[model samples]
Target: MSHYAARNAQGHHRVHKNDPEAIAHLKREHHKFRKLVDRINAAKTPGAKRDIAVELHKLLASHIALEEELFYPAVKSRGLADEVKEGLVEHDIQRFLSAQIEAMDIADPLYGTRLGVLGEMLVHHIDEEDDEMFQEAKKLKLDLDAMNERLETREHQLKAQYARTGRIRTPALDREVRARNAV
Candidate 1:
């Protein structure tokens, strides 16, 4: 029997056959991201806006890394290649916009507009992932508990690396930023 089936036999019926813990973690992060964006939008001072933007950027960078490195790969291995590819493309767009936003002064007129656009894009992306990709992953019966533990470990490692370097780093995003800077 599958891990989930065995667990269900023990009355853990709420545990999904896939990775419920990982999905819950992702959902929590999504909620946090939306709240952070809302806080950014409501900020009245330039300093407040800048601080919130930095927080949002860090959260987004880490969240993207978690999904791309672990969750998406697991999904793809389960035959969800198209969803994974689409997600990566969206992450690229988000990373590009994040870089642009990071370079902007909070006082700049375009700053708010750019932030708004990013928020909209993120909302749409989150909705699609939660509704479609996650649903597909569930049907594929992924080992979500193991994946969640891996994601947690990776997130901590990334956070420590960021603290040491003073930058939110993800391999793919770092390369993309470097390429953009080169040109």
Candidate 2:
């Protein structure tokens, strides 16, 4: 039997699939993300598109922080770091594109096209997680309630900071920290 599975009372090998409550929350967030992207695509007014994109960006940042800070570490502890490597890169790519989108004027010709590309990449990334990373997580011995609480706590922290400062962390702050640490 694989390390993640054990013998049942009937002497049959049983595979473990610890479906954390956080997984459900992540799925719901994924659904919301898809809806927001669809709203952006279908919006008739530039103002509406810009508003929805801003909301989407805030939520996306929180979601990414939760995954990076908590969810990915938990999975990586189970010897699945390689499985999540692509996801981390994907997050960085999305963040770069998002920054460009935020700098863009809605009237710019590439604005719609950039949003379209981001939406396409997001859908592809989510599907990849659902198919591969999620399946891998199912085998790990993650605590359902504890994992959920951890995710919620991280999300709450990110959301509150975003509400107060309009961003989780400013690039200037990051650079300052790196400079201070280098001394």
Candidate 3:
């Protein structure tokens, strides 16, 4: 039996698909993005509005990239194929919206419409991950403590990469981390 299954006395093996630390980080990013969105909507100066919107776009895009690269793959590999697949589709949808948001003119009257659309998509995407994916991941019998440790390490690496290079070094580091931690 796997170490994970061995640790859990239950007959069935447990899997912790989503690490709490990573989920917490994602939630924080969501909150930050929402705040930026609100700030974008409330700003009076076009320059300030545009600047906030641009930064908000970059933040959302990077957060999504990090999640896709680090988080989703780990959860998907934990036997939740359907959930991960759905999440990928949602990620694509969000990416499309992100592109739209990125391209929009913040000074245009239609900007509000695009921002509204982006907000709706973001809210829905976050809700799905938090409610469905997270709950299911929490039930998995995997070593969440170890997973969180790996996530912390990877998040640090990703942060450094983004800081120095301004790009997410992707595909995913999760697979390698998971394999190394595999029972």
lDDT per model vs. reference? 0.78, 0.72, 0.62
Better of 1 and 2 by lDDT: 1
Using TM-score, give the best candidate's number: 1
Task: Say which candidate scores most in lDDT.
Answer: 1
Query: Can you write out model 3's per-residue Cα lDDT over 1-183, one digit (the tens) per residue?
Result: 122112222211122344465566665666566566667666776667777866666666567666666667777888888987777667666666766766766677776676667766776666667667777777776555556566667667767877898655455443543454467
TM-score between candidate 2 and the true structure: 0.80
Per-residue lDDT tens digits for candidate 1, residues 51-158, read 888888888999998997889889999999999888888888898899899999877988888887897788678767877888788788778877899999999998
Considering lDDT, where higher is better, how would the candidates rank from best to worst? Answer: 1, 2, 3
TM-scores across all candidates? 0.81, 0.80, 0.67
Poorest 10 consecutive residues by lDDT, candidate 2: 3-12
Model 1 error, position 143 (Å) = 0.6
lDDT for position 32 in model 1 = 70
How much is the lDDT of residue 29 in candidate 2?
74
Candidate 1 matches the true fold with a TM-score of 0.81
